[model samples]
Target: GVVGGRSVGVPGTVRMLELAHKQHGKLPWATLFQPAITLAEGGFKISARLNTLVAADPHLKKDPVAAAYFYKADGDARDVGVNLRNPELAAVLRRIAAEGSKALHEGEIAQAIVDKVQKHPTNPGKLSLADLADYQPKKREALCHDYQVATKDFRVCGFPPPSSGAIAIGQILGILKNTDAAAKPLQDGIPSADWLHLYTEAARLAFADRAQYVADPDFVQPPAGSWSSLLAPAYLADRAKLIGAQSMKVAQPGNPGAVKTSYAPMPDQPEYGTSHISIVDAFGNAVAMTTTIEDQFGARQMVTTSAARSGGFLLNNELTDFSFAPADAQGQPIANRVQPGKRPRSSMAPTLVFDKATGELLMSGGSPGGAAIIHYTAKTLYGVLNWGLMPQQAINLPNFGSMNGPTLLEEKRFPPATVEALRARGAEVREMNMTSGLQAITLGNAHGKKLWMGGADPRREGVVMGD
Candidate 1:
């Protein structure tokens, strides 16, 4: 499923960070990279998770460079606590710091990316130098929705398409709120069966709409009217009415507007891999960024500079996110089909919350879970806003949600009675590992003083630090 150039799309990370830094950075450009450079040169210990992942990946060993970097002389993965150095990476960072974004976007570095992508031994790609040179980062308006829980209300904002995050989360939460789901309390400090039932059903409905309507906004238009129409109160109420005490098992897409759309629903495809960052500056301006290169280690092609001194970054296989068949069996074109200059559909959900009445910033959060990103973000937001759990406590909760399929519960986390109860109500319960990496920061008052609370997912090697 992961390989050469066709899988590759123009890598936007360098451009994305460059734009963000230009807008909000207060420190000098070079100073911001000191920590990373230092770590790369000085070496850092490999975490258990990284070691396990390296041993598990079947393809990483295929790349000679990756194999050399990640494995030991005996051909086993480098063990946990081993100090791994990356002089190559350190060299690249220095160039990027000195020349800014141009170092990677143009000239020598860009050419190497094109070569690695197109010249892969077994799986060649279509990316070219022109594509790399033409890449442009876009800045769009963040999508915000007003959410009410009992007497408290808040405004939640998330990235808009080519991300299906905000729309899906907004749709699910909106539909749930239309019913009595929000009013139901957590039983024994866990989401009650009633709440989970509604939440999972809403997830199926939202994912149904997601598969049918969401795509790169530059290429695809929303169904009835604007994108906001999908989350409209009346529309969500109509959609929520379909949830009738039992799991629908699988859901069909809804018509969110009056106008007829032209695209077919994209078929189920495996979507995975991402990293999230949530930061709040002294000025109180916050950022939630969800970055990825499609699957782990991107297209599995790492490129070095012309001189081969600096180690390179992974290229993204983002194009694979598009519907491969392009059309359904009935001949209707899929909305998320690949096209030149079109970005792929994504599930990265970077979020910001605000007090609706006073417009004060409340929280920032995001996660990496492929299509389940919607459920993870919704779970965290609901935990913080509705249950008043601290960010770490919310993130530590078990992960559960569906992508319009079987109702999945995190393996071994719930009581046996909980699984049987769902099955009795028509849900096909699947228990397996649902590793969700979530990061969050929230603001609240304690002991008559305002405090900043931060949380990181225990599933990965992430830590929250504040001064």
Candidate 2:
């Protein structure tokens, strides 16, 4: 999901999916309707996290409809079983499924959005009808690369720059693969303390590079090939030789961490609301798509006009993505000023890796979770490809992601032994509540049966089905 203010181009992707359902879908569009229709017909169950976020940030209560759906009769937000109603959204969905996508981009729905955005009260967006009228969803090839480690070749494919996760993972794994460290670092092998130290240092290096060079390709093109080269085996060998057991926190090269976080909002918070789907059509047209409202619930305002009920959600709060503080000229953070119309930086890393030889699809997966999405994917890939674990075992693994902050490790999913081992390594650990909801497909092939697999984030209440 691309969200934030500037990302408020056009938001009828759900309509697009309806028109372009994958050729291999097990259930028809009308069939899928029962699930959501049931929810909207009855009511949405307020999730634990949803309640917590509302309670912590009371400003959310300002949205009467949203608040009414979550809160009790008296006003307290629902705890777990509360039913949230959105007849309007349901009606909108029904319209798109029936009338086709044109109703969204050119009909009354589009007009409502164009109207609302032009008159926004707080941080009003200066979008022109022409901008909305000219918007179109474009497709591009997925970013990918290949590397061989331990005599086994691995192809890494992920959303390119603008998405730091894919590139960052490529850099880190590239370093890890070529390192002289023992192949198996986790399976009760390397002393836990020593291993965690090594992992943290490596993470630090990758993150530094990511922050410095990662940005929307539309704005500043990333030199993925050269950057990947410098971090390749030979370069990693030299860096690995310099890895002493001590922790070292360094600043990003081109952009320094010396830049302070500012109160001013980030520029391109194109928090495109995104959800992913992976399917290997029976006809062999494997499909992997990431769709979103751009940010959490999209631009928070909905319209209820008589012509039709449409997606009321505004653009994402992505404007907060750019540096809000002051900086020098060069667009380089005099404080990361976000320019209008620039695609905001994102962490969405939708990917599809292929079989090295035949070039058939190996794995297709993507997540909607923010920055951590990439880390979650890498861990799962590592488990299945490197450790020989089943897809389920890999998906069920405890999630751990750290980009210089307190390392976020899951609380109770993995074997307690592994958690205890890592905690003792002096790594400041943080336990999070949810996991990345990852939908994936692995093609069955000769080298390995083209297996189609999908793993949902344990933190979410959803399941996957395929042929």
Candidate 3:
């Protein structure tokens, strides 16, 4: 069931992913888990943004664990350099790993979760005990959308519905790759004002469609065929009509969406959600894992009773991501509306692009970003297949995004000269932090040497692994 707004639901990726790790992991779960487990237990110094968010919550001051985890003894938010932890949380996680997820829904963790929700305003208003008991992590059929990279045909494939990232972003890029506007991105060598304009316009049009139609495939069927089928030359022709080559601005909606912003009291505030891993081995199988606390530590509930100080974490408020207004003239509340057993919409596009020749996984990746995820993957993919930047170079190079909102330009990445150029192209430019905090890997022969490369985002302190 949905949490706050239309929470993505009990993440299915965890259950199936755990099974996948057990089946294919080269290292034990204990080993792969060392980083986050250590960070959470010992407590990494909380990010400034996290401290600010926790203090913003009305309930955080009311909850003792929350108070200790985020606030100092003086009863104020922790300063930037301070370290923190919830021994209770570390214990819950240990139990989750040893006993498995049943502990989360129907066992000890479940009882606490039920009690918390019963006492909490958000869940009590939305979900019931039966819904929690009946909830099941989803298993979906794999999805594929056709694409062409140069003369060769490639299929960008991933799990459908609940994970809409791969299909939506892949389709967007696929269409642009074939567009006349994009034919000579690297060949022209130097990018001009016109090139950046075309790219930004194309992205904005694609994002508009995404916000309108994409949702949990388990509960609502997407338009007709898959989004890939909708990415035809004819369709691209229609989409390009929305972009202009001169200064422009998208009008924001006069009112807040979904639940009216004023009436929607914020839940205990938490930091932005994040955690991810991408793995590909010799067997040609690859897994890209993106985990989160939903907020800095999720719902701010810690499992107080547990066996060891090894397990426990904040739960997610992903429920807040759903569309509040529900429906239009067409009865499509699930357009992002929370359903009894539906997954919420997400930008998590753990993707695999294949050569189809040896059936080898050429590139497998994904990132941890809220809504700007599409362009984060797009910029990287273009550099890999089209511009031929080394994996790290592609990921590290300055990033840009035009996902439905304003054209987001990173501070140092876009020079003042480029900003003037983009502004000349009819775009409303917003200088901001546009990081997907991504990790990526390529398993193939480069210059006849067998190479596997990985790069993590420095923005949020991630590490790449290769042997």
Candidate 4:
């Protein structure tokens, strides 16, 4: 399923980095690539994580070029600590460093990408040289909201539409804030049943609205007068009234902004893939960026030079983010349906939080888990801002929430009583692997000096390093 042309979307990470650097970079543009280029050219030990992923992947081995590079002659995945060198990738980065992003978007590298995509053995894609050449980065206003919890004032800002993150998270947290749930403190060192019940119910309601109205703003108009209409305090209060002593099982989208609409709610679709980066420059500017190839070893096809001399780079399968079914059973269109040149809907919530009064950066955090990203981000936000946990403590908290479906608690984390409590409230509970790769850094004091404390999810191999 992963190997094909349909999986690829025009790769955007390069353009994203380019835009970020253009706006906030203080170092010489080419200087930034030195470390990566050095690592690629000099050969680095293959990480245990990379080895395990290579061995676990069913399709990567089938690509001759990929197999030759990642596996031994016996076909076993290269062992951990193997000093693998990618002169080609290093070469690619060197070109980008010298020539800038256009090296990847145009010229020989771009041609190779197009050829590999359209000339695949079986699952060739439609990407062309023009699509790659035509790519342009977008600049939009950051979405920010204020929250007051027990006299603490904070402002949360996140990527706006095209990404359903900030809107959905704002809706869920806002709805919860409007309820008694806001005061349900942690019990026995964990979130109490009452707290989770209210939280998950609020999640269900938020996801229901997410399915209905969130999409690329270029193509789909916000349901209400503006995107903010959905997050209006009054609107959230009205939506919160739907939560009761028992679960609604599934909640339906509310009519916000009181606008007439014709779009059908998109059925829950599989959402996956991404790597999150949270950065703070010396100048105090911070960025939270979540980038992905849509799935692991995206597109299952690797791009390389003609003789496969340059090795390979994974292509993104992001186009799959679109609703496969353009219309619902009633013939009404889904707002997220695929269209030419439209950015697909995403749950990638790269978020930045700041102190309300001073406007000082408070936290930069995000995760990778498709639709569940909303819950992962919300948990971290609530953990750090509400319960006063350290960033790591918050990142370590068990993942739980709904995709407008059955209540899902991370398997083996919640006690049986926790499960029963939700079921007692009529929540259909399911426990399973909820692997979230969360990277976060919080600003606070240690002793007397200011610090930027970092937390990487215990669920993955992420690490925090800074000067």
Which candidate leads in lDDT?
Answer: 4
Worst 10 residues of 4 by lDDT: 303-312
| Model 1 per-residue lDDT tens digits across residues 170-195 | 99889888888767877777776777
Candidate 1 residue pairs in clash (backbone atoms < 3 Å): 5-125, 6-125, 88-311, 224-257
What tens digits encode model 4's per-residue C-alpha lDDT throughout 107-138? 99999889878887888888988999999989
Q: In order, what lDDT does every prediction score?
A: 0.86, 0.57, 0.60, 0.87
lDDT of 3: 0.60
Model 1 whole-model lDDT (C-alpha atoms): 0.86
lDDT of 2 by residue, 1-467 (tens): 12223335445355446545653356666566666766776776778867775667544444444455445657776686666666666775666666656556666766766766665555445666555555554444556767564566767777665556677666666655655433545554212445555655566666655655565555553443233443455655555554454455442332212222222212222222357777667667766666555556555555544443322333445544444443444434522335555655566767677767777777777776666666667666766666655556666666776675455666664455655555665456667654577776665445665556666666665567865
How many backbone clashes are present in model 1?
4
| Preferred candidate (lDDT higher): 3 or 4 | 4
Tell me the alpha-carbon RMSD of every candidate: 1.5, 5.8, 6.2, 1.7
Runs of candidate 3 with Cα error greater than 4 angstroms are 1-13, 18-62, 76-86, 121-126, 151-153, 181-192, 225-227, 232-234, 241-272, 300-303, 306-312, 329-334, 444-447
Candidate number that wins on lDDT, 2 or 4 = 4
